[model samples]
Target: MSALPWMQHLIVVPVLLPLLVGALLIPVAQNRHGFKFAASAVSGVLLWLLSLALLGMADGGHWPDGIGVYLASNWAAPFGIALMVDRLSALMLVLTSTIALAALVFGARRWDRVGVHFHSLFQFLLMGLNGAFLTNDLFNLFVFFEVMLAASYGLVLHGYNLRRIQAGMQYVAVNLVASLLFLIGVSLIYGATGTLNIADLTLRVAALGPQDTYLLRIGASVLALAFLTKGAMWPLGFWLPTTYAAASPPVAAMLVLMTKVGVYALLRVWLAVFGDAAGELEGFGLAALSVGGMATLLFGAVGMLASQDGGRMAGYGAIISSGTLLAVLGHSGSAVLASGLYYLIGSTLAMAAFMLLIELTERIRPPGAALLAITMEAFAIEDKPEDPVGVGIPGTLAFLGLSFVACALVISGMPPLSGFVAKFSLFHALLAMPGRVPPATWLLIALMLLAGLAAIIALMRLGVRTFWASGAVTPPRLQISEVLPVGGLVALCVALTLQAGAVFDYLSRTVDGLARSGSYTERVLGEPPVMRPAGGEVAR
Candidate 1:
């Protein structure tokens, strides 16, 4: 179209600005902590402002037809990489930036002290994240994904301990394979459709006959597998707990955005490309997706029930939430979009708080002999450091307990919080679906309820151990620095509950954007009725 708007410039700036600052932060990583922090702040502020600008534009119904494409060397789509932000991408942008900023501020405390290049790696990771979320081309998406993973390699191994090294190795290995699958999938799709632009592929993949359906399905499966690895869905997610546990808290919190990218890609590409394929089959993929989603939900709950460690437990909970979202996606009913969006918000918020709580607990517990004496009095041979039994709370532990309660209720889907609101919307969506209710759907509901109960029990056990148990040891007092982060998150959760109506409406609008992929394709591709192929010709 005409010259690119100033706002589109803001989008690319978030991606490139961080990379420049991250590189700059590296050489000064050791000596000038203040400089690193300032660099981080500048990058973080720009990202936040960019996100807010996108949101404002979206609110004003900012659709200017003819694609908002930013091309390097002035090459167009299908030949050159491009960054494109639709309404949904912009929403994710804001959410990712907000969470990253919070986590960076929380994480910098230790990284700044330890001579680590935390600021640099953090910015690099953000660069990867922002680029991945905003890019319109598949190859460009892969590039951004790898860029993010590389930064993760450094962040996960930041401490250089045996645990960090081992965990990072596993994390890198799993994702490397995932990246390969991603590239292979891209190649297959390209070979089949002769285009890598996602919007173009959506128009082409359906034209190939049923004979080629197998290849398309295989391609879709490969891409889904790569994302599943990212989403931490069951059987593919073993690396998440170990790697996240080993990393610093901010790093773990920051990494949460990555899985959502996987989920986002799954939602975006499948709906944009393959959903059109399944349109003729009455949404056949929904059944398979629901089955996998239920399995993941149950798998994660089982892991949570069997584990006592706080960090690992939080990781399992995250997996469970991911499954819940996937399951929502599998429901082909009208409300599925709303349900998926609500659950997405709830799960992200709960997981964020849970990660922070785990870090807080580890920091507050007493070390060594005193810790042992307390455990001995409580009748345990060794201190299960993850569950600190017999500790009395008067200062920091009290506030931590308060946080734990918020985390437990929100995560367990208790009422009056965002989690409950989200789940309620999903359940309502489920029941509203037409035709006979499938056994699998009912099973999912039951499993979700069961998972909620199990998470509640685990969280209760943890709370009693760390906050309420009567024994020999006292918890270290919390500094404002520590409390502020946890307190701020808790406050945010409370606000989420208070503004449930407004948030739910926001979620509804977002889901509307998701469910109607035609509108999205139309907006990006400058065509109305972005339809699938049908009757031996590409459907329009």
Candidate 2:
């Protein structure tokens, strides 16, 4: 049978179906708990299937070009706000759906109590996420972001605790300002270029003279800052740790998908729109990317070292990972892109698992004590399998040991794991580039190495105190439900490491398209001769 054109519906359905499902589950949830779980599970399974279908379609070489949209009522772009999907969009869709499914399944028990509409907000959030990834127009992107962020407000505040409320407020405030900036930036671009269609704007920007180029660059930079805030770049990331820390396990797990949205926007809109055309502008475009990225990485690592809370530390680690991703993007080579993509997959998986694990561990700590301080206060509590409070997960000591060792190997750029491979590819890209590996580059490498060592030592010390300390009492019993999600996530990490070659190959192809402007435009706007940066021909 021939594939139906309605296949495009698969993309929209992942977002829309969940919203509808959530609404359906609301009345039944209060009466039948099993129904709620079933709804979430069915939704998850359907989304996963859809994601797999998307992957197959992308790999089939049949994907369309130039801002694809299957409108709610068959409307077109710039008129009805199209939902576009390129390879980048497809990749993000798969990742977000997978994470959402995993998080939902892992938190099935919790959702049973938190109310059925939890799934509703979750689906609505995913709608926003998928929309953000697929939208081609700037105003639509902002609208999607608000949709997602507003839902996140509910999700983050779900537990109804004072801390959750405070954190949620801070999150709302910071992101609100960032959103305003995003709108302002988009308006400026519209004013300057007289167009908001990304493809058309890209072409017009390319045709501008040097003065107009500066205006475009300024607008682009402002736009990038808004995205940076969303992505948790340093100085703008203060709210992330608190919000993630205070949120419930499922909420925290789902939030991991949000950061990638910023990275994707930067890659899809910022870099794609600028192309080689803006790279040649005198005031450090790609060069600034490297510097900003490295700075963010260092800030994250330093914050991690200073952090005394497990959830907060995980948040910082995520920031570090984001920064590393941005730096990898800056290099703009096949190796670097491959490494960045690999790291993105692995780090996101691990971070989600770790966040859930922190939540579980939190249950075992003293009422006010954080998970990061569990070891320091271990002696106060006795291990009680019956009680839910002050009892850490059984064998968590062992898990913590394993986590420390794995972390050391991964972050230190050691052999055999995904992080090592990614860093190796990135370094190779640096070496292959024309000039020196920039003093800033060297500083980042040094900081990363140091941070890796610090993480190893800190995690080991914490593990030792919690696991083998002479006076410490054992904490509470392990939650079997909790174990499955984190373990599953860790298992994925191992699987990704094993499949590093295949992952790198896919990324290499994607990176090739990104590094060459001609390939990008041809895929998006059809084949055309183009003026490129550094006085070179990007032939189709």
Best by TM-score: 1
Q: In candidate 2, what residue range of length 10 has the lowest lDDT sum?
A: 522-531
Whole-model Cα lDDT of every candidate shown, in order:
0.74, 0.69
Candidate 1 lDDT by residue in tens digits, 446-482 = 9889888888887777665565443444676555656
**Model 2 residue 126 CA deviation in Å:** 1.0
Candidate 2 lDDT, 308-377, residue by residue in tens: 6767777777788788887667645234666677778877877787777665554444443344346445
Name every residue pair that clashes in candidate 1: 533-539
Residue 73 alpha-carbon offset, candidate 2, angstroms: 4.1
Error of 1 at 122 (Å): 0.7
Residue 459 lDDT, candidate 1, scale 0-100: 77
TM-score against truth, every candidate = 0.89, 0.85
Off by over 4 Å in 2: 1-4, 26-31, 64-80, 209-212, 278-284, 331-335, 363-415, 470-476, 515-540
Residue ranges of candidate 1 with Cα displaced over 4 Å:
64-72, 276-284, 368-395, 470-475, 527-540
